[model samples]
Target: MIGEELEVLYEVDSTNEFLKRNYRSFHDGAVVVAIKQTAGKGRFGRTWYSPEGGLWYSVLFKPKVHIGLHVYTKIFSVSIAEVLKKLKVKVTIKWPNDIYYEGKKLAGILAEAISENNRVVAIVVGVGINVNNNIPDELKDIGISLSQILKKKVKITYLLDEINKYAWHLLVTYRNEPENITKLWKKYLYPKEGAQIKFKHEGEVLEGTILKISDEAMYIDVGGKVHVVQSIHELVE
Candidate 1:
């Protein structure tokens, strides 16, 4: 039911922005898909290279619980990863947001909360997938897509609908189930437990292993010292 009203546009500055700007006019499961995003962005305001042929879209949700934005992100990440896995893509999540395959980024999921009268009215979750777009030469080492992985063009419409169906189920389950969301994300977590992870820490690259995860932060063991990280930018590979 997540894509009750799927609206496709040829272009947009940002699907997330467009949805937030018109959330009041659309239903809870309304989605906006863009063929090209001129000014798309990822975590930390990094400019996303969303050229034509890529899958860029945002979904509007009004869940029953006022959970943290981070929880929504984790839920959506799993949704996207599971869908990709069904395509034999073998994608994994880089900590809290990015979807990676074989150490390269396959997709990125971002979420932002919409507020009204000091209360959240809706949350917009956006995903950008490099389906058939050509990865820039400079970013080729860090970027990937379905077309590149499958060696064939992918049906954007089919993939989009599948992701939405899975995401809707996960989001609804999260709303009703009294369970830890982190447990679910860990299933497809990158650099699996005890694996050496080199991430940005205090202006220095440190090698560590993820020891634990909580709703607020992840505990990493670096040189016998445990560090708590709450930012995804620091943990992204």
Candidate 2:
């Protein structure tokens, strides 16, 4: 069972960091959550703003060797999106792992691998959802909370449980039926096929139309030339 053991903290530097540092001490399904994170982390060395009222947590999982680390981020993110939609939040996913509502970010995820001898042994997946937390006016254009969208405060415990339940169900489905998970996740991804997009490549920005998205890369038609966008950071939007 996922998240069968849990740890709740008042504050922490980073929920993901806590799990990684103590990776050996906890069981495979253990989870760690914090009310506030002073030094939250984001993708590509960016900082994750995790103030009070958001759900900041990490899950420890030791999966099969063939599993790609990136898949955890995608899987968990879609689970979050599913839960929000049930609340009538109308959430959508940004490829590679982010939840957005009307172009503003609602959540982000970070999944790291614990490796030994060049082989991944475990993964720590951290998730952050902007719930009832106050967003500064300057950052309001890029961030939003559940309360802001629903016009009411969402109970933190209830939301957390919903997310965990959906995630675990999807995980089990993935293990038993691996073929359809990707399509299910892609159903909510934004910038759908044929959308015009821009990105930085080799220090120069290029424009393109999204052709297709595979697990490892997004095939884009740039000036009639297909350029594979393998990293989410390559996207300019």
Candidate 3:
């Protein structure tokens, strides 16, 4: 029931952009939901497909703590995981900010914040979840949606309702029990173990085995050398 004041739209380049440009004078917890985004973007400036039949929305916040951007991104991902789990969907965090289902990306998060004098002014957490769209050929190998996997039409309203409830819960809990967020994130990590993943960090390609996922990040064993990664962009495949 948090920010149920939905500003539903037909199309926009980015919901986050809309909030950033217009929410300066608005209250926290305002929400902007869009049907289609011409230029939806993922983490690290990658293009996101937000044609239609998906949930594209952003929630505005002025956090109590002015944490680093990286920490905020983790919070965003954790929030998404919380909501997806409530909807009876098997989801996991893919670090930095992606929600995965059955080894393919089901949702992605993009967080944009405005800070002045080292104080946070506004934060827009953008979430894009594939709900009812047919999987495009280009992304079939790397992406999967709830509707596609379940063979049933998913309603945007249902997804949005869960998002509203979970978002409010996370925001409230974040202030009193931030550790709970990290604990839930660790509970559902993609490729939890025994899976080989390719990563590109510091301009080098490395393959590694996923050993464990924890509160800080993922424990990946690469050639007997373990690396704990927190950013999703650092992973290539």
Q: What's model 2's TM-score?
A: 0.93
The residue pairs that clash in candidate 2, if any, are: none
- Model 3 / residue 142 / CA error / Å: 1.0
Model 1 ranges with Cα > 4 A deviation: 178-180, 235-237
lDDT per residue as tens, model 1, 1-237: 788888998999999999989998889889999999999989878889999999999989876668778777887888888888888888888877889889888899889999999999899999999998999899999888889999999999888989888877877777655265667888888656667766787799887888876646678898899988887667655
Clashes of 1: 0
Q: Clashing residue pairs, candidate 1? A: none
Sliding window of 10 residues with minimal summed lDDT for model 2: 63-72
After superposing candidate 2 on the true structure, give the runs of residues whose Cα lies further than 4 Å from its correct spot. 64-66, 202-205
Question: Candidate 1's C-alpha lDDT?
Answer: 0.85
lDDT per residue for candidate 2 within 192-235, as digits (tens), equals 78889898888999999999987677899998899999887799
Estimate TM-scores for all models: 0.91, 0.93, 0.82
Give the top-scoring candidate (TM-score).
2
- In candidate 2 the C-alpha lDDT for residue 182 amounts to 78
Q: What C-alpha RMSD separates each model from the true structure?
A: 2.0, 1.8, 3.2
Q: Sort every candidate by TM-score, greatest first.
A: 2, 1, 3
* Cα distance off (Å), candidate 3, residue 144: 1.6
